[model samples]
Target chain A: MLQQLSAQELPKVEQEMTDFITQYTTQEDLKKSMLYSIEAGGKRIRPLIVLATVQAFQKTLNAPVYQTAGALEMIHTYSLIHDDLPAMDDDDLRRGKPTNHKVFGEALAILAGDGLLTGAFQLISETTLEPTENVLLIQLLAKAAGIGGMVAGQAGDMAAEHQQVSLGELKAIHRGKTGALLTYAFVAGGILAQQPAYVLTLLEKLGGHIGLAFQIRDDLLDVVGTTEALGKQVGQDEKSAKSTYPALLSVAGAKDALEQELAQAQATIEQLTKAAGFQPQVFQELLALFTL
Target chain B: MLQQLSAQELPKVEQEMTDFITQYTTQEDLKKSMLYSIEAGGKRIRPLIVLATVQAFQKTLNAPVYQTAGALEMIHTYSLIHDDLPAMDDDDLRRGKPTNHKVFGEALAILAGDGLLTGAFQLISETTLEPTENVLLIQLLAKAAGIGGMVAGQAGDMAAEHQQVSLGELKAIHRGKTGALLTYAFVAGGILAQQPAYVLTLLEKLGGHIGLAFQIRDDLLDVVGTTEALGKQVGQDEKSAKSTYPALLSVAGAKDALEQELAQAQATIEQLTKAAGFQPQVFQELLALFTL
Candidate 1:
């Protein structure tokens, strides 16, 4: 069901994202580099998460929601570009294409990433949301994506490379690096829909569970999934000696953990829908998409 | 007079910047890396420009104004951190100390820069400005600091390395790279003070002139100033074979161009003050600080 929704909405998200990026498309090489990354297609999961969550509230998609979705994708793309830099992950390919630095050189790649990150804020600020809501959304994004959030997570991950990290330490790193932005998508949808405080809390809880589950699944895929399927190198954790869920927990144990998280997420959504006196069928479908 | 005002407000700007950054100060190495760059202070020129511009409009310093100033400084610091990365300029020294990448490694240095940039928007969004004004400020900062602004400028500069560039191209690069944010400082001050559109235009024109003059002076200093006095490597442009005003125009001609920019900036301030029916003494003092 969520796949169908994603398929329906993916074109719209891509169009909106292209439109937003075109605003900066001058004749410069910098603009070309920036557009190159955005045009490189992904599953568009982040924007879909945003749109699906908004739909779960029975709210029709609006400009603010679409703009937020586009901004989130830009942020995600920027992170990928920076992560693929020579000083970082050093990947030569991403999403079956030459990485940003491979196409635009290291300096321009870095600048393109910088431009996208800063441009995200500009997109949100220009949205037609109520001022108070706009501020809240911006605050949410900055906290999730900024210093104490994803950036810090990336820093921790880098520092822990080739080192033995405990499960607790690994969880902390994943929470910041992978979990923050995912959770922000749900929370942002709730904010846009004007969900009650209780619902917002439930959405955050659901996001946490789903985020952990998503990371665990990713770890499993890196170990088992093909580079063809994954669209990039696999078993990188083993190669780099980076810690992973399957490393800390056995494969079976990791699978067990993933199931537990999915269950928790489902329970939270159930409780939230019950309290709100409506079934969020779209959210339930989204959870299904996460299942193997 | 400008120096006196900067001295008086410098500590306050430092204090506010420290306070804003402190919010992300965890025991994590990421936080330490971020702070390392923030604490290795420069002359705090950007924030002072913001404060002085506000004073030009006869406005008292307030929380929003100060926060914006601090945020501007953070953005400036972030740019310095990235520019000094090994993948970029490969500088090991900044502000008379080891550069961020030197102390924290390339990965952490990149993350720290990302943190500062994203945190800057968070700082501004959390300010107490009216929603309209806050959005406008965010838009201005994003435009001046994002693509088609500083990032584009940096890209052009990097691409021009070891190559010939026309005077027009040089000015275009400096306009985006150096002039955008400097001009944004004045325009931001005007927005915060509720100045009219005409005054805002004058501020932007003033910013463009000063920004160009500032870059020319920087190039001149590279030719004449010692590394000890400059607090960084000297004669880098010549070493890297990057074009500069001093390269395109002779040293004497560069000095003449700088003088012309100063004169144009001064004239704009005079016209602005005369039209606005205010003395704009603070602006005059700021112009003096740039005159050398």
Candidate 2:
């Protein structure tokens, strides 16, 4: 089932993204760089969430929502590209391949990232999604990426680098940076389906909790997972003096928090699945991905 | 009359922009940095063009055009903030003040730039403009800023840095980077006023010619103007090995090209003025600003 879903659904998402990127890139080098960052191997978790949420709510994958999913992934990929720049995180590897800045040079990499970032907005504004929903998506995505969200999280991350941060401060940081995008993914999917505003708000809170849990798990993996397993450098957080759940909380304490967040997220979605033929299988599988 | 325009119109524009920036900033340091970049000053040429174009067509500033003028200035300011970054142009000075990166450090400068860019879109989408006009403005602004336009020009600028670029190549670069915004300014003004499509197209073309002429004149000024007059480091283009009109075409050749572009632009507005009661003096004064 995992293989089938990954092969079919994931490629559709990838192709949609490729098509969008092609619209903006003409230069062979720029196209190459954009592809390098975008096609670098990683599970398309964010896109999957979008597809799953839309699927869970209704049968049809609305065309505009599909574009939003692709655009969100582009924003995610752009962030990764910039994060690996020499001036930023300075990582030479991502998904076991040369990082964007490493492959494309710092200048092109910067432009590629900017291209992807603005391109997200371009995709959003150009979509034929219902105007009200379109407006809502733009507002939600802007807040996610702007102040009090992902970009702000990045600012805080950069500012707090090497500083002694409390557990609370670390959670706030993670919530802003990582959680912001995850929250946006869910809210955007919900908004596109014309889900109730209350339900959308609940999903945002749920996604935020899961996002925090997801990052903590990664931090734990970085501390313990082998380079081969993680597909990149391990213990990078330790090297950079960045605070993480593993660093701030005991391993068991971090695990407890993760489990608690998983329960909360599951609980929030439980009522929404009360209808006929509602399969909890996908929900269970998603929870397991982070829980494991 | 020029002093009155500067004293009255320019200050009002400055205050409006200052108010916009003040909302997103609370940190004294960040405020100082943002204000330094914003207030360090330019001719407010783009916003002025937006206002002048609207007045020429509608005889008064409608709500949509008024808000859009501010938004255009925001977009223009965002480009400057990003352009002056260490990784981009590496300029430490702009408009007689420290560039954003110089004052805020590179990371905050990047965030500031992102904030400004995203904020421009937010301002436009949420405007009290007519819904149809709001939609058109969003579309126009996005196209101007995205892949084929302003940012594309920046990409070309980066690509051509340190290379032997021809006059045609330089014109293409400036057209995308500089001309795109100027074109958008005039077109946006025209759209907000519900001007006919033919008039809008003419304004776009006219704006492009002026944009190219503006760039050529900038090259001329860089070589001859005082730092006090230019309000930034002059002759830095030579230091950076950038190809300018004068560098590629000789001062005399560049001068001839500027005159030709000016004539073409004047011809466009002349037709517009003949068909409608559009004020030609607005653009006439602007032509004098650059030419005289």
Worst 10 residues of 1 chain A by lDDT: A273-282
Pairs of colliding residues, candidate 2: none
Please identify model 2 stretches exceeding 4 Å from their true place: A1-5, A26-28, A274-281, B1-35, B59-66, B274-277
Question: Weakest 10 consecutive residues, lDDT, candidate 2 chain B?
Answer: B24-33
Span of ten consecutive residues with least summed lDDT in model 1 chain B: B273-282
lDDT of 1 by residue, B96-170 (tens): 799999998888888888989998888898898887778788888988998868988898888888889999999
Clashing pairs in 1: none
Interface RMSD of 1: 1.6
Q: What lDDT score is found at residue A208 in candidate 1?
A: 90
Q: In candidate 2, what are the lDDT values of residues A64-116, reduced to their tens digit?
A: 76788888898889888877777667788888788987877876787777777
Query: Which model scores highest in DockQ?
Result: 1
Q: Please provide, for model 2 over B1-292, each residue's C-alpha lDDT reduced to its tens digit, 9 standing for 90 to 100.
A: 3434456665666666677667654234445556667776787888888877877774666555556877788778878887877778777777667788877787677666666666666667766765556656776787787666777778788888789987778888898789989999889878866788999989999898889889989998887678887666689778778899878878888888889989998899888885466877777877787782
